[model samples]
Target: MYSRISTVALLARALSDQAESYDYLLAGAGTAGLVIACRLSENPKVSVLVIESGPDVRNDGVVTSGNFSFTGANDRVLSYRAGKAVGGRSIVNGMVYIRGEQAQFDAFEKLGDSEWNWDSLFSYGKKGERFEGPDTAQKTAGVTANPADHGTNGSLTTWKSIGVNPVTDINGGNPHGFVSAPQTLDRDKIRRSSSAAAYYKPVDSRPNLKVIQGNMKRIIWANEKKNRAVASGFYAKEEKLGVKVKSAMPGVGENMQDHNAMVIGYGTANTLVGDTPFATLVTAQDALGNKMPVLAASSRSQISTWAQAASTYTGGAIDAKTYEKRFQIQHDLIFKQNVTIAELFPTNLGSAIVSQLWTTHPFSWSSVHLKSLVSFDDPVIDPNIFSLQFDIDMLVAVARKEQKAYSTPPLSTFVAPNQVLPTNATDEQWTAYVQANAGNTLHVVDTCAMLPLDLGGIVDSKLKVYGTSNMRVVDASVIPVELTGHTTGPLYAVAEKAADIINNDS
Candidate 1:
């Protein structure tokens, strides 16, 4: 229903309706924008205009795979909201569903305000949930609903994948084993449609709901005081076919941020060590039913067996060389309870795809800010990946730990048999390797945080922008604390509750 609004018509309408502003003007159509738009428009009386910087995601095969198969389908929009796309990044994520640790949110409370504390904020976490998993790991991992942990009925269709990767434990036996299972994706199809698809797509028919496609340039305020400045709207321009792309007028821009990642590649199959002090927070053991000794490394491991049933490329979009490089399989392992997960992309090609070590829950911080004078043009992104002190230290330690896991009996027998990761195996050797490799998990967050305004927080406890009267942020951006699970599930819950709050207030 929203796919019809064009740049020309949108501009014409805005010029004519400056005085009678939309009850709500949400900038960007990524995770947060979709939620705010869907929730606010539940009431037919209030007019809500959602400005997206990209195109719709209705028929994109790459976005639908909802798995690793299509993760790189679209270029990363580190610059602006997933350019005008209706679904935003939810259309491009690992699809793993997880909630932040209770202690984490409690820390937010300690660092800032009561409204952000675990006690008060837990409800919203649950409210946005649509639990369809068997809760296999729930009891084992101490993840259960206490009214604050989960929600039963939400608009998003959340569930465990009917199809699971070989690495994940489909049956709730050993809680520690790595299993690759599809999350937030339907097994019947490869695509991972987001809440925007399930929730907003169905209700765009409402007259009050108007989705306009344009590059959001800036966030214009009505007054001088930053907090008092009511967010009026944003500037937008159409992309030119070939001629000069028109410049948009300067105004307010949407402030976005995300976590940057550094992937560490190793030469051998070995277990990485977990964060020392951090180990106490977890409980680990060998795969259930297997007598194999459980290595205490710090990363999580998953065995993914899913491959694109059909060739991803029709002609030569991806040459055979590229396909071989991306599709090689290697053994996987998890260490240190489950802080990180490692995948071994095996290949007889060059060095033999040994083990690919990754630092889960990386501590790096970065952002997505506007590039031009307008917020609508793609935002400039640095993800300033690897900026945190703890981030580098963790990489060094994990590399050492993985080397140890490879030394174990059963795994060692299959691994280089003798040639393992960190071959020289010393603090120096591991450190050099760490410095050389390490990319992002692509799990970005916290561009517009939800907390009290006093603590440098943009959004309030209710997820509303602090200074605004009627606006709210209901996507991954509103998430103040980092989530232990992937961001999509939590985003769903956030949007669900946002809908309730707006509806109740209306």
Candidate 2:
């Protein structure tokens, strides 16, 4: 073992000695990369190297503050935020940890990814989490839990929000009603518990694992046959540090998706105050109740229409039948399985409840493409938000329902006599407002989707890139479908499962 003082130098010498190849080369030292590296490095026989674009931010106060800000790509159209440090977005995101609806995972299984499902992923979810059950104060506040769904021995720590009742286990495949879920935080320290803190920090002394800071230029394909390209390695450049490195990985960067969100702030007269901004959340069906069936039926046809458009957009990369099958799975999750169509974050803002709304699934697809093969340029990102009319319509309906909720009973009594954001705004106006003000939740996934190659999938169920050897994508990019919950929980589960898969394969 190398001492703390000599570790960096030793790591540099090791990298210099083994510059040509590594047992495993990870493109980004973010959430997925860190988890995989730590897990793989457990075996002293394997050599692991992780290349990150950002600096070592393990002790940076600003990055570890648990507060969020939009970085990377911020524009009028889309304000995209992605953490550039070792922990990635986990360091900056709202720490709400939800396992997502069972139906959403089932949809992934139905997409011909047999290995993916609720039960299987749920086990992985537990594998990566260490649940900090409710304390005395929290228990009195109504926070209950199912011990079976929680893990006692895991890397990440989860804690219940104070003064909130845990109606049901959100991980028990049903999160319909109001429930107090866990957050990825160090309750004792009151600080963010990111993947880097939980996974990387523990194993930083491992001699086999080496993490280098540099921006990935592109995947160097050994064979570029358009359809049968094989990955050899990647080129990276860090100008500030005057460092450049080339490492191997064919499936470096591909398939990208993000959660699109819009906030509907409502001013009220109630003096609601709480340290936690939002501790309670309700699914769309729970919020809409009996009036959901009609709207669900009306939206069914749009699935096929979207599939057709998606197929055309891909230039037949995915067949019409495949596209329809993929979209139909999503349709079932939303309508039949009752997956969350929209999420509402009711923040008690002194004199208002800024009801943030987020659409669970959007038909739009975007990409992160390299501008050139040789240059270390930033990847061109196009988050085609509101490309589909259905997304806009769904958001509009969510806004309308939120308005209705504000006007009802106990909630209405707290509201100010006057309405904010025009309570009686027409459908046209709401739609226009959503279009102009909506932004992404930074929960991006599915760029290098894990589906069969015939269905436009970049990676397989095992996360291996389809036409290559020794290249895998174990990040949010492999998620085939958009999920109802935040990306952190699912991604932790994915990385845990990915480690097992890789170990088993080896």
Candidate 3:
């Protein structure tokens, strides 16, 4: 019977043939799930199965950062904007690689001294990073060589942008005055090609490793006398595959949440020269056969590139020399100067820059829950985005700060003397403008939080679900607290640590 079945057959058959039984069944091969799957399958003795809710992203242009021109959503592979894709949001993520501030991790310890404290978790963070990019710049900017800060050897490839238009000055300092964005991309600058590419691809050849494509609706529960569930699996629907429970093991889908975001757009007079368009800069390239200036990018990368475009078009000057002078002045007049430091990204056209001011650390909370028992349905995501008043107040403050930054001395002469969004120019006017155009940060987290049992937590200190024996939640959903920087880096670290935990336990 085994000989009759081809290797091209279903994962169920492959899994059945490989081992008498597999040790783990991972669901939702998103950013975190894939990491866990690969690590657990590393053992020659253990067998693992990874059930993805979307299709394969092998050559999908939309999922590959190299194909920056393909702006349309890839419904076939990634589950972005409600599409059933395999790579999950990583397929369409901004790919902004950032670590949580030391204080943020320390704060978690203060909040109860859980296993995820800065001291205990730092090693895991180091294990997940694969830092690349120019060493001098990364070091001078406090990016590399700081063993206390950065990780050199890890699975997820993190580095400064390559193929990036040179914005540097003669001194070779950062052209934009700030550190280059550490992106969650490969050495090639491809987005969505995360640990999945590094771990899953190679390991897929292993006899014990099985990766399947399907939707994940909910956890199938196996009761043990009482109503309390004992074991679990995924409930999914496929056209030819039909409805089935691929996972013999169980997982809990209880805890869920996401970070809130708001973007600010500023207008420019000319077609400003920047990286691409929008606040979230993922990928950008000049139009083929024409350098006159046309950008193609995913929505996430558009934000920063668009902002840079705005800067160039509106004539907001930025270069190494200018920023260096500004930095020097600010350093000398530390307290004296009213500095409003912020992040900026350039777009391709160089016409307009969408100045995005996200709250970064939102005080409000929300969650994602299952809509029904069936697989292939979207989850009920109630992010309650922008519900908190503090978030709004922060955005307003940031707007005022941006206005002042552009209005300051040397910079003022270069940048236009008017507000691009609210022409009238007041805090109130800025707030109104922001309210109408602000959007999400896409850093969703905290539904399946790892907290102490007394704190209404879903997972334990080790990331194992509280009620279940073998079940664990390792994605961003399990993060108890929001980080100061973007979530991708920290999440990768969490997944790496989770892998160690699962491997040791198994």
Candidate 4:
């Protein structure tokens, strides 16, 4: 069931006999694109075509293996990483699956998106996952799950790692405490269960669907002068195969956003052991402990500063009032709601423990635009990490707390006596260290934000571009807000809901 059209000649021949126009044309065969294509192709009447930049790397070890390297900019300002294969970042990311907190989704509802609350979107979450029960060893280690919260039949497979403690369904209402979450792995639990494997492979045999390996040039617009623009098709370039195909769609590439992360690495004397890549996960309160109030106060005091910084970053695209409101929403999530602010990854490197500290969210904005019309030219991506003062301050605070965690109890007993990176440094020195060493977590979203057009929204709630008809952006770019967990879990849910919307449209 894996039909890969790697050559332009084969693709051209495949499309020559078919209708000139397809019922649906997807611009990227990555995470969101694959899900949308699979669901839309369910109906035999519809013809779906997906154009992807990368080739069919289904068996590429660099992509399929859990220990994969990054490919993107590593400049002083920001270090951005994105996958160049069919499954996108899913094939390269650390497979930790977290659905995020309920409060985060409720915040989306308050932001003029009534249909995006936790209750409404929870089903989509279940629809895309097939959860496996924890084994005897895992259950003995305190693993727990609620059967009602998991999906029995779904494309994606998930299971808890061995020797990890689990809480009552991490997908349920609360994810505040320590819990061992599931990962996107196959049944054998060796290879990664990427979107290409889960959603695309199962339905590749359908004659109605075609996946072409190529790069999308730009969205072709039907009417540019109209109040609401309409799309016809798009131009794609496949240089290796020497093909240039024009497919349909407008509002193709516009909005782009990425999660900005600061990694605080600590060298420990004792080797912290774990079968998987990550060992323990600490929430904001868990990491900060008694110092939680300091963060809350800091968040409150920086409301105006945040608003001004965001407004400036957007070039006044977001008004002062809207910026203020957005800051307030983020503040409430950080302070009142008590969402997950930091994630800790403990790894044993030979004789020392290298613990990675990541800030869950960093408030910064940037975009991705084509530098040239050529297919080989990479798109210009600017995440603008640490553009705001608040982001730096938040990351510094989290790093300080992570230092404290390494110094305490069971972990401290195992770790080395002396510090590694900022050894016995002052607060100012630690801040400088963070600025110099912090890197992104590779969870990018909200470029094509789902919101009202008045608020710099490129796509509607249905994942359809505002000014276009019959064209939708079903990628991580549509996510307007950052989630407490990884991007993949929520992205699957978003794509699932998007497919439902596209099908239900009259």
Residue-level lDDT tens digits of model 1 in 451-483: 444333566665655545545666666665554
Q: Under the 3 Å rule for N, CA and C atoms, how many clashes does model 3 have?
A: 51
Off by over 4 Å in 2: 1-21, 68-76, 154-166, 218-234, 237-256, 268-273, 277-294, 348-352, 374-377, 412-419
Question: Could you give me the TM-score of model 2 versus the true structure?
Answer: 0.83
In the range 1-506, model 3's lDDT, one tens digit per residue, is 00001112232422342322445677767777777777776777766767676787756666676333211011122122532455555566666665554445654554453666666666776675666654563345343223335567610111122211322220111122233455656644544555566556767788888777754444545554243334445434333333344222111232233433444444555554424322221111111113112311222233344334323422442322322332233222211221111233332334544445444443334445556544336676554444434345455554554455445543344345544554347667655655565555566665555655544456777776655555677777677656544666777778888788777775
Model 4, runs deviating above 4 Å: 1-19, 68-77, 154-166, 223-227, 237-260, 264-298, 348-350, 373-377, 421-425
Clashing pairs in 2: 142-165, 233-248, 234-247, 254-447, 255-447, 255-448, 256-447
RMSD (Cα, Å) of model 2? 6.7
Q: Ten-residue segment with the worst summed lDDT in candidate 2? A: 1-10
lDDT (Cα, tens digit) per residue for candidate 4, span 12-120:
4233423245767777788878888899899998787887777888877766665533221235755466767788778777777787778888877787776998888
Best by lDDT: 2
Report the Cα lDDT for candidate 2.
Answer: 0.68
In model 3, the runs with Cα more than 4 Å from the true position are: 1-20, 66-84, 135-148, 154-177, 187-192, 216-229, 232-257, 267-348, 409-424
Error of 2 at 493 (Å): 0.5
Tell me each candidate's TM-score.
0.61, 0.83, 0.67, 0.83
